[model samples]
Target: MGPVRAWRDEEEIELGPRQQRAVLAALLLNNGIRLSNDQLIGMVWDDPTPSAVMALRTYVYKIRKTLPELNLKSRDGGYTVRAEIVDDCRGEPLEGLRSAYFDAQRVRLGDSRLKAREDCLERELDVLELQKHVAAFPLRERPRALLMRALYLEGRQGEALDHFHQVRALLIEELGLEPGPELRKVHAQILNGDLTLPRRPEQLVPDLIDFTGRAEEIAQALRTLPGTVGITGMRGSGKTVLATRIGHLVKGRFPDGQIFVRGRDVANELLRAVGVENPVGDKAALWREKARGKRFLVVVDDVQDAATVRDLATPGSAMILTSVRRLHELPGVTWLKIAGLTEREAREFLRKAFGPVRADAEPEQAEVLLERLSRLPHPIRVIGGKLSSRPGWTIEMALLQMERESRLADVIPSDCAAMMAPLIAAEKQLSEPERRMLMCFARQDAEVIDSRKAAEMSGADAGEIELVLESLAGVHLIEPLVLGRYRLPRFVRFCFGLRTAELTS
Candidate 1:
């Protein structure tokens, strides 16, 4: 009615009370159609006298002056406001000025469902309610983000972009934090201005994988001050898997990031991976350079020495490294050698791999099988795979096979031996009596023993046990438990045990 009004707002508009009431009254009466002089006078000032007509004219003049600036107008003897008809084929209004209409609708409806008497009218209101929720989303990175979305919907692309940038800059200065990942992706899309929207998969929520058995020890380590976690264990003893899983739990709070690196005392293998061929002693510098600019969740697996790992960690990056030995001399790095998977996780892994064996499918047999598997993931997997192929095989049958190989001292593969080559070389540097004591202890069947008992078994003096255990612990051959207690990480134990047994034989 008023030149097909483009939806617009006055850049700045302030009106006195009388002017505001008078203009609002006219717009309400003449939503799109024009209001004649007499009609305007009756609407704005209820008096029907001649001066009332003059007052209406004065109000109309002031409104007209402001209206033009916002693209409204008066023509001939009447005042008219423009109505925008969106071009939508299905009668669903196209975005543009209609977005302002939607925004107003959302505000009016709020959270309440609109009700109507007629079924058709009720259906229409329902559609408007849904459209309001979709188009006028309340959560955004900032208020200006919402404003930008509104303007973009209203076909004011240029203004929307300007406002978006202004908001981004404002947030950057106001909060030191950068825009979140979601906001960054949204901004990139707006900058591209492609109408196509991306649909991302809903994130899968996390569930706790049952880590029964070691709960107390793991909890104690996790609760330790400074949050530095160190894990050492044999290959295939669940050390790597446990480190990764725990790192994930710890990283939620350290969002600047966490790092995991597979470390070896022999740094050359990894040095080659990070583009350091012929790496001189400056490997840490090369490593730090590679780590620069990335806020990472880093996992260094196969760690052989604490010093090597400390050298690789970029401070401020929470780090998790795995090794088969403890490096006690390396200060500040928290030392925690990971234990084998508890009886439960190991059994679950077996059940998953074996596709439900008689032990799980048959409750009477479950306990018997769990005992035979000894709660070690590698052995459990091997045995489970074997059992899966031969369903009728009894747990006792698998136990016999496990017992034979399990007692064969150390049976680590040559490739795994390659992983510990540098540590092996470091062991050679130990004094002969220390080496012989390690060899004798390595040949023993048990995985853990007190230092005094170890000395007795190796025929060494009790006083000498502490000093030798300290030296071996430094090179990571074994880890001390308490004052006199000590245990070997599965892999380190297996490797050394194998070596010690072979040498003795």
Candidate 2:
């Protein structure tokens, strides 16, 4: 059934089968465009003979007569569907509602990388309810994808995985074609937790032109006395961005000396043997060697596990450790948490990215550009990159084809290697109970949950769960929200979630 509605304050009219079919064909073909009599005739009926023209007029007359009843209009010699007749909410512009509608759909579809899974699942349920009730509406590929994503995000993992497999199988059996790599990747990402915390390289480089905002936060972290300062945030929220930016900003302050090693390499040295037939005493050995030389400013990014991060920070050395998990053990470790970008900041970024191309021609293009970019810096960067070559794309057209032409992940890197080290660390430190707790949250939709609730969900006690959360938190695999709450950053969440699910499932 198509989703359609008629307007109030107009005569009520019902269309016969032929008239409904003809009008639907015309509306779909013209879609916000003007269509002439001949164009309408051709779209409605393949070829109109002398009588065919008359037959076209008969159908057109029926549609036209029904329009007043439905408040539709044939303006400028072309039929235009009236928004009033759509039965959608009033006062609010249809475009605004449509944008919200699609955004809700985007989240529901789990394509909205910015929002957490819990939020997306809620939206998916709302959209599914709408889908069951709406009538006389144009169908689209988007709504179908939205449903699939909703199911996937709703923690219906087996069902979601099966549906994607079924889609792949059907595409092969019916269309004799393979699903596109992007679709396959999305399916894999959702099942494997890749979509939750896909990587972005721009987050790592502080000097990059794209790194805007977070200056104040970074400055404050750098100004935190002389003790060990730790920067933590949700994945893709810019912990490393702030840390790297602070390092560059304060490099002059620490001109005497600086030492930096990423957590992964640091952990490798700490965990394994160094010389043949001899075990590496502790990973801290290397850091002890490096800091022994001089006064240095040490910056370790993605410092997973407390032991690994602690090795790099000598008492005298100025050190900064960036991680998604919470590190409370480092006696003087000052914590700085990064939050999401404000709507205004995200909008301003889109304007800057798309402003140049639409400078003279269209003032409205900026709004269109902003809408398409969805206020995410990484995706906005990609949109800007694509528009750099073709300065002529009207904002509307560009946005409409945004998802159709490319998956959002394609614009952003998928490896997220810097973010994955914590998971590796967490895996290394896992105890039987901790492993069970981590796997429980890893497979669920919520990024973070209360410890009591998590323990309840996992059939464990608070004391038992705290040890796991703390252990995971120690290595930067998960972060503590307040007293009992903990959250997973997308990066570590993605890798470990997959591993956790694979192991437990």
Q: Choose the strongest candidate by lDDT.
A: 2
After best superposition, candidate 2 residue 322: deviation in angstroms? 1.5
TM-score of 2: 0.38
TM-score per candidate: 0.42, 0.38
**lDDT, candidate 1, residue 389?**
74
* Least well predicted 10-residue stretch by lDDT in candidate 2: 197-206
Q: Write the per-residue lDDT of candidate 1 for residues 1-505, one digit (tens) a residue.
A: 1111233464445443553444544464345887787666655444357777666667666666655643456678777776433322232221121223344433443322221112122222243343344245433353334344445555667876775566567667877556566456545666778533112111112323633345554575566423456676534455666666666566554433343344354345444544457877777777577555333345667665556666655554445556666556656667675545666666666667566546566554655555533445655555566777787887667556544543555564443345345446656767987777766665665677688677777677888888887777755556678888777655554445656754555
lDDT: worst 10-residue window of model 1: 114-123
Alpha carbon lDDT at 231, candidate 1: 72
